[model samples]
Target: MSPERFARINQMLDNRQIDLTVCLDKVHKTNNIAAVIRSADCVGIHQIHAVWPDIDMRVSGNTASGSQQWVKTIKHYRFEEAEQAFNAQNMQILTTTFSDTAVDYRDIDYTKPTAIVMGNERDGTSPEAIAAASQHILIPMIGMVQSLNVSVAAALVMYEAQRQRQLANMYGTRKLDHAYCQTMLFEQGHPVYAKACRRKQIPYPSIDEQGQIVASTEWWQRMRAPDPQALTC
Candidate 1:
């Protein structure tokens, strides 16, 4: 598939049907953060919650190719806020760390709502984040190094999620809410695709139709018809 095709599919996934998040905790390196964002998008994750004290955005902006615009990034300054948000949603917070209770990273189930947290490159997950996590994961290794960089570790974990959820055919036909999807694609300036979507009864998106970056399902509904066969016949 071409880059444009990939971008379209990514926009589709951002409709929030994927149910996974990647968050960084006060990570110092911008290149690594940028790479993490890139990796998250590469693997079909379109929402990222990042918590960093001071970020050198040049690193992320350089690699993102405006890819971040296609994704929703909620920035946080405190671990408590990040923890409270994901935890309240019952999202399984899995952190990469080599602690006594840490399990092999491959053991965790990624099919459920999940948030993978990566901590400071030098310090690993903060004590607070580790405590808040539902489980601690470690990438097992037989090599000379015991740990990988923060960004590399995140890539490995998220791909593991893709492997499990995908091998099970978890997302192929997963349909998001019809209305929410249309608004998203429409706002993406995909009027043609939006018409196709409404004609097919696909989900309408929830984007703010009048906002700066806008997409509206109402436009599609105005031009398209509900499936006739879906009616009482």
Candidate 2:
């Protein structure tokens, strides 16, 4: 990669919010999903969880504007699976819903490990999702519409989290651990080589300061060899 491109990637990785993420529950609209991914990228969120049991989690490239390529999206067939994964990471689930117990979205502590859950375009948040949430938050609406589109709402909530995190100096330095940063940098900068290493069941080669792979020719030859276990099969 060019020095400028490498520097840009390094800067983005440095500012990535590892503790913050967004979860979509059955959000099927392509445009909305694309918009959410775009907003997530803009806010420096590295990961996004999607739970759509009945439909494939597909977003439009046009609407996503290449933002989807930067964000890591994990798809779950069920809400329970997604919830468990986030819980395992010690992240607090904050669901957006219209309920008596729901508070303003800005009231929560975004500087902490958080996963904001957004619901479907039509039904809002599901009961199970709401029940699973650690907190219920909503964007106040005084106009007749009462609610905004899922994408718009997600952008609002994500930017609010960004704003809070910024004030806390979370964006001033690298938050992601060294191992994850290295892995992500290598994967993003040399995706084809990384995928080849995965296929060969070998560890990824180290990357230089300029994002160039720093592996010996012998190592490359070894990595190209068929896996012994697969050969036995």
Q: Which candidate is the best by TM-score?
A: 2
lDDT of 2 by residue, 1-233 (tens): 66877888899988889889999998989999999999999999988999978655679999999988788889988889989988888999999998899999989999889999999988888888899999999999989997999999999999999999889989958877777777877887878777777877778777777788788898889777877768889
Give lDDT tens digits, candidate 1, residues 1-233.
Answer: 23564456545554333578888888878788788878777777757887865543334688666667556677887888888889777899998788898998899999888999898878888888888889998998999997899888899998899888778676655355555454454545555655565666665444433322233666456446655655655
| Count of backbone clashes, every candidate in sequence | 14, 0
Stretches off by above 4 angstroms in model 1 are: 1-11, 14-17, 54-59, 173-183, 190-233
Can you give the lDDT of residue 201 in candidate 2? 72
Error of 1 at 225 (Å): 32
Measured with C-alpha atoms, the lDDT of residue 15 in candidate 1 is: 32
Compute each candidate's TM-score over C-alphas. Answer: 0.71, 0.86
List lDDT for all candidates, in order: 0.73, 0.88
Model 2 bad stretches (over 4 Å): 177-179, 191-203, 220-233
